[model samples]
Target chain A: MKKLINLQPSKPVRVLLGLLPFIILLLLYIGASDARLADNPNDKLLPSLNSFVEAIDRMAFTADKRSGGYLFWQDSYSSLKRLFTGVGISAALALSLGVLMGAIPFFRAKLSPLVTAISLIPPMAILPILFIIFGLGEFSKVVLIVIGIAPFITRDVLQRVQEIPSEQIIKAQTLGANTWQIILRVILPQIMPRLLAAVRLSLGAAWLFLIAAEAIAATDGLGYRIFLVRRYLSMDVILPYVAWITLLAFIIDYLIRLASAKLYPWFHSQEN
Target chain B: MSYLNIQNLWKEYGDQIVLEQINNKVEKGDFVTIVGASGCGKTTFLKMLLGTETPSRGQILLDGQPIASEPNEERGIVFQRYSVFPHMTVLENVMLSRELESSPILGRLFGKQKKQAAEDAKQMIELVGLSHALNKYPHELSGGMQQRLALAQSLIKKPRILLLDEPFGALDPGIRTDMHQLVLKLWKEHQLTIFMITHDIKEGFFLGTRLWVFDKDRFDPQAPNAYGAKITYDLPVGDIDKETYQQIDQSLTPSEPEIAEAS
Candidate 1:
């Protein structure tokens, strides 16, 4: 018999091992909820699985009394819109600034220090200032998310661009490429996959900033709904909303990874 | 006038001199292979020829005119690594050289121009014997295949001078021999003037029409940077005998005192 350290699991065993934790957690939650509910029949802390299902149905299937739209979908749509817009703007800004700073010494000297300084400042610290200036609206929420992630994404992009071997740039020049030509043809295509990767890494931080802003001031959003229901100790709604957010984040992250693998096969292969 | 001329060329970084009092002249079809110990400024010399590095003093003249301080289409280079763009497939990599030349602003060719560029690139790829792997990325290629792709990438530009810096140093011996035949064929067929730097003395002798040894005539143990390397010996390749080859090999084989003093 092999020692424990030397033992290797087969494919099916590995899959079972991965699922074990989630299954255990689910059973524990169900057992705890049953005990709590049997004791008082009005336990808000660990609502029964049935309560969670009913809460989800009410939020998702039923139309809101005040608003004509379904509350759950409306919140998700608004939150996703802000998230994508903020991240999209951040990605575009980072790519352009990064390529310039990385490739050209002039831009690097002038802007690199400033970018570094900006990245060092805590983005959350400026949330109040953003709300004050841009006001308590969709714009401020978007700006907060942008401020939270853009500098980080920009720095990643700049480092990646700098990481491009100088030989490739010189070879491009020998092919009669001028400055613009080299950036467009040689540098830009290579930096793109890196940009996608940077964006994916920043998505967690992006969502954090977006939700925090929404909770603070938005009329309708996933974060807004969760925070609003907390007044009455509405764990049923809050728990379901948290799960939905986690699922959304996971799906987005998975899609980005899949897209990167398909679109930039060379980049992934090089990583291996 | 010679096709290329170097008149008392010097390169220095700060107070440290890398190459000093280098002078050479080459005809259009000369294949000059440079061999030197490490840190002897062989690569700096090649970069100077490629126009990516400017001489700190003096000038390099091409066709009786001063060479551009920046790299241009007249010269092409292949490094030991990062010679080909990793993002592009082999076909796209070769096509890009022509595309950049044809369309300056967008760095892209379209319709008839694109089709013509692809056709030319395919021919060049075939010349390098990479026709089967046209759509493969650089990461998919073996070292020798990558070098072949690099060759195709550079050759498509029709450079008058091809600069190679230890292009086969990392390849297996069997692959290196295959690459040698491919390169010689390309050199003859294209009628290109080539400057290749290699650490291997035998490779220099085997590949070049002329072999150059870069070594410092003077060395300062105290300052170390007081004197720089120069073209100590320039021999026509076929005229050299076996004894001379052994002497050159021993001199460049990294003796402790020489390596320490040079660095």
Candidate 2:
């Protein structure tokens, strides 16, 4: 008897398998929206596919009269700038501080408890304080993302550094690495990929914090626009904004994953 | 002063005596292997010699100077596993010492020093038969290749002493034999002082110019730290053939120490 399917699918089939769920989701949403619009000509809850396409076209293609800029591109740029700035700061801080904490006993003893406590605190809880101290501007928003993600990244980097086999450090010392040298040359390279993984994990929280900050106080941003249209029950605008955010997050995540694999081919194989 | 001298060496952790009254001398170019049962403290002793641990009661002098309290470039070590830096390619692993030395800030040395480092690493890799694997990471290499990488990484530093803790314990019999020959050749060619610990008696006897048997002379559960593992036998193995190893084995007994005064 001939088999209906091979045990493992080929590349094209594998890609189709991955895309199937998203296609089905689009179909289901479209069907629901079609039914709702059929019931009510002005229904905004589940907007018609035409409404979403029209909204996207207006936001993406049309220029705002006041600023003469595409609102979508403006929102995207502001959001990404804040997001990358915050994540980049957090990652850099984590790499330097975490290596010291993990490698030096004095630093570990002094900082580990503080890191644990900070990681435990809900970053959202400090939003009010951040606004009070840093002001309700770009500074506050970026700091919110940094506050929300830095401690976790630090802890992750610390753990990865600590997890490096003591043998490697000892070997490096025997090869003439001083304290700083061991931290920089031996421990840092080992923890770098893990640092990338930490940054990727923290991206979700970074977005959450960025959006929360923008929603509360901002003239322009993806989150501000979503919140701005919500009062008018403009699901057309809000849904697309949410989808755009998701698409952006997915693209960044995928890019980071690809970069990690390229930069650290050994890390993936070492796990197996 | 001897090439390496240990006087009244003792190690204790919270009244748990690990090594007690360990005294020995090793000359330059000596290939000494210490053999013992599990939990016999040979590894601990090796760590002390590597300066990872400070002795409770005595000092180790190398070339008439006290060994540093922390590991330094004077000593190199290869453990049973986890010795190779998995993050580095073969060339980078071997070049790390010179690279770190030349460029302390960047973790890389550039231009002429970089070229020199590469040349030195390439030579060492070729010596270890890993020239074909210069670009390969540690995980991509086989067990023997990884161990060879570790050796190359260590030897590039040109350390005064090389320590091995069951380095061949994980290899197959054939590979282990080849590694033995390789170590011997490296020792002879480099004139290295080698101190290896092993569980296999045959291996210990076969590879060592001198051998130390570590065990407790007296046992007391009630007062455990009162006595601990010591060098029970230190014998000069003039030859490492089957007949010689068998003769030494036959003459061994429970109560009597065999050639305790070799050093």
Each prediction's fraction of true contacts recovered: 0.93, 0.80
List the pairs of residues colliding in candidate 1.
none
Q: Candidate 2's residue-wise lDDT over B166-254, tens digit each?
A: 99999999999989988998999999999999878888878969988887878665575677799887888764467756654543333
lDDT (0 to 1) per candidate:
0.91, 0.88
What lDDT tens digits, residue by residue, belong to model 1 across residues B1-263?
Answer: 99999999999999999999998999999999999989999999988888888999989988998988888888999999989999999999999988887787899989999999999999999999999998999999999999999999998888988999999999999999999999999999999899999978879989979999998878777777889999988999998777888888876876566566568
Off by over 4 Å in 1: B255-263
Work out how many backbone clashes candidate 1 has.
Answer: 0
For each candidate in turn, the interface RMSD (Å) is 0.8, 1.1
Q: Estimate how well candidate 2 is docked, as a DockQ score.
A: 0.70
Candidate that scores best on DockQ? 1
Q: How many angstroms is residue A10 displaced in model 2 relative to the true structure, after the best TM-score fit? A: 4.7
- The Cα error of candidate 1 at residue A93, in Å, is 1.2
